[model samples]
Target: MRILIIHQYLWSHYKGKIYSELQKIVNTHKNDELLVLQTSLNEITRANLGPVDRSIHQYNYQVLVDDYYENIPNTTRAKKMLYWVRKFKPDVVNISGYYEPAMNTVLFYCRLVGIKVIISVDSTEEDKPNIWWKEAIKRFVVNRAQGFFCYGSKAAEYMLKFGAKPHQILLENNAVDNQKIASIYKEAYQTRETEKAKYGLRPFNFIYTGRLMAIKNVANLLIAFAKLKPQNWGLVILGDGAEGENLRKYVADEQLEGVTFIEGQAWYNVPKFMALGDVFVLPSYSEPWGLVVNEAMVGGMPVIVSNKCGSSHDLVKNGENGYTFNPYDTDELAAIMKKFVDDPDLIKSFGAVSQSIIKKYSPEQVAQEMYDGFKKVMYEHK
Candidate 1:
């Protein structure tokens, strides 16, 4: 079997790890082959994360454009993608998204050629408001696919609402490289004391790592932190974005001490910062799938994520691993944050559960699930 994946960009370190693992799995099979065609090297929105090192991408892949994804012309992307599809003659085509005109064109061509399509879906129904016309179009496009590789239950449920069958839902786990992150966290843990002193972090730090965008609700996190006003507890906001200056001003205006704002680090270097925090928090009002939560869980840090996040449904076990609160309710978020501050012991206990829960969402496991989905689509669906 030959599998071809059309991805928007080659910038995701998490996806690169999964693709590399999937490639290794494909190689083990005598006649199986896999190839990924990425539209561009990176997306303009992700430029703050810095250049993606090409050396880490170990899978068989071709970059269709050297520019950012948004800058790539649709016609050029469609032509290059079609050229690769025709040349490869793949048995299965997995499209990363449906919104792009180029991806839609490729999907149409694949359907017309009788080649099975497996849509890789990360969007949940709650990610955005549903307009009737847009939902209708989504239904039309979704029904054309033979299979789906969903990021989580929320994504699978969203696809089901759009007329995809349960059986067609193939791979459900969206993951990062757990072993790599855990290993990095372990090494960083060795120098934890030095790093903590270097960064001037407090004894107990609640860390949020990601772009400081409006949707991330970092201001709400600040408000929650202010409500506590604990001397020993710190709030670490890592990553720079459009709202960086505004958040800093708000923090200064409120005179919120023990709050540290660090610029974004490279993907590989993020876990090093993760070692400084006791618990991880993602208070996003809208997040499809928070892979940062996965990284935190792998690093054995309990997470306080918004219920709106897709990962909260799959990864968070409520009070077990960590609590999920409504992003809109600052009081609810504040109460949850106080849980860690009041009883410091809950951090270690909850973090232990986080590690155990995250074990199943490893790159190796997700790659095997994807390989199984490819086989099922190629054989059973036929």
Candidate 2:
């Protein structure tokens, strides 16, 4: 089978891991070919995260239009996609996002050529504002897809609203390099205190690693942390965005103690910071799938995820791996934070559960699911 995948960027480390694994799986099958089309070199919005390692073409089956800007969609995208489609003549085409005009064009062309179409869905209803015309167009486009793949149950549920049958939706949940990250975290865990001393971090650190955006509800996290006011516990906020300075100001104005702000670094260096923390918290008001939760779990840190996050449905088991709280409830978040401080033993126990649960979510497993989805679309479906 010749499969073509169209994605926005290969800049993400998590995406790199999944795609690399997929390529490995494809190599094992006789005459199976996989080609990934990267539309953009890097994202404009996340430029602060530093330069993307363009040397990520570990697979020989990728085509990157380094000149294109993914944020801006126009007729040129249709031309570019059709160009690749004609050249590749793939048996199946997997599109990255539903909203992109380029992906929609590829979907249309694939239908014309009797090529099976698969869409990678991550947008839950909470991720986007509900607009009738938007939903109508989305429904129309989604109904045309023969196969649906997504991050979790919530994402699969979102597909149902867009006209996909339950069987047509396959849960290709997000993953990180669990084995690699776990190894790195083990090293970091051994020397955690020495590292914490260098950075002036507390003995017990609760980490949040994402953009400092309003949607992330980080201000509420700060409020929750302030409520605890534990002398030995600290909150580490990693990543920078429009909300960075505002968050710094709030931390200063409130005189919040033991809240540390670290500038965002490259994807490879993230585990270094994750290793210094005892627990991870993602209190986003709206999130499709928080990959950081997957990373933290692989690193053996208990997570406090928002119910609003799509990953929480799968990655978090209340009081097992970690707790899931309402992002809107500051007091609830504070109470969960207090649990880690009050009982340090919970960190090791909860983190163990996190490690156990995270093992099921991996790039190899996602590739197998995706391959099965493609085969289903090709030969099984009537």
Candidate 3:
């Protein structure tokens, strides 16, 4: 099988990991070939998420465009994507998204060439408002594809509403480099005290490592943390964004104690800072799939994820691995945070469950699932 994957960027660390796993799958199959084409150098989405390490690395198969990441005004993108598709003549094409004009053009080309397409979706109904035109467009385009790949069942469910069949839906479940992230956190855990002291973190800290934007609900987290008034525990907010100063100001005006803000580091260096915390929390009001939760789980730290996150459906086992709460309710968020602080023993137990639950969501597993879907789609489409 000749497989070609179209993705928005190569700069993302987690996506890079997924590519590596896919390469391994190709290597295992004697006649299989895999190639990935990256549309942009870097996109605004990544640029806003703080510092990123854009250093390139060797992969078995990858092609990157010279142009930087921008959605509009890329007049040549359709021509370039069609050129590659014709040259590669892949048996299976997996496009990473549905909304990109470039991808839409490529999908049409694939139809003309008789190549099976597997559309990837990372959205749930909650991610955006339902629009009739968009739904009609998706229903038309999605039905043309032979298979669908997504972050989890929520995304698959969304595809079902778009007229995709149950058998056509494949889970490439969002994942990270479990072993690598776990190893980094393990090494950091040994000297967590020194690390925490260096960052002025408390002995027991709850960490949130993403942009400080409004949709992320960082302000709600602050409100919840403040409600815990005068506790020995601390809250570390990592990453910088438009709401950075506003969040800092809110923390100050509320006189919230032991709340420290660390500017975001590169994806690889996140574990170094994350190891200083005993628990991880993501309070996003809306999230398709939170990959950070997977990182936290692999690092052997329990998570407090908002129920709004898609990963909570798979990675979190309410009261087992971590707790899931309503992001809208500050009181509910505070109660979960207090549980972690009041009983430190739950950290170790819950952390163990986190590691266990995360093992099944590894990049290798996703690669295998993707390969299976490819075979199934090819056979059915034939």
Q: Which candidate is the best by lDDT?
A: 1
Give lDDT tens digits, candidate 2, residues 27-105. Answer: 9998899888877767776676767775545664453556537554658667777888899898988998788887898
Tell me how candidate 2 scores on lDDT: 0.85
Winner by lDDT between candidate 3 and candidate 2: 2
Candidate 1 global TM-score:
0.99
Please estimate how well model 3 matches the true structure, expressed as its whole-model Cα lDDT: 0.85
Predictions in order: lDDT: 0.93, 0.85, 0.85
Q: Write the per-residue lDDT of candidate 3 for residues 1-382, one digit (tens) a residue.
A: 9998888776777777777777887788899888888777677756744443444233454445655567535457777778889888999999977887889888888989799899989988778787999989878998888899889878888899989988888774888888889888888889888877887877788999998788999999989988887467899999988899999998788777899999977787889888988899999989999999999999889999998888888788989989999999999999999988889999999999999989899888887888888889888668
RMSD of each: 0.9, 1.6, 1.8
* lDDT tens digits, residue span 152-176, model 1: 9999999999999999999889899
Clashes of each: 0, 0, 0
> Candidates ranked by TM-score, best first?
1, 2, 3
TM-score of each: 0.99, 0.96, 0.95
Off by over 4 Å in 3: 48-58, 62-64
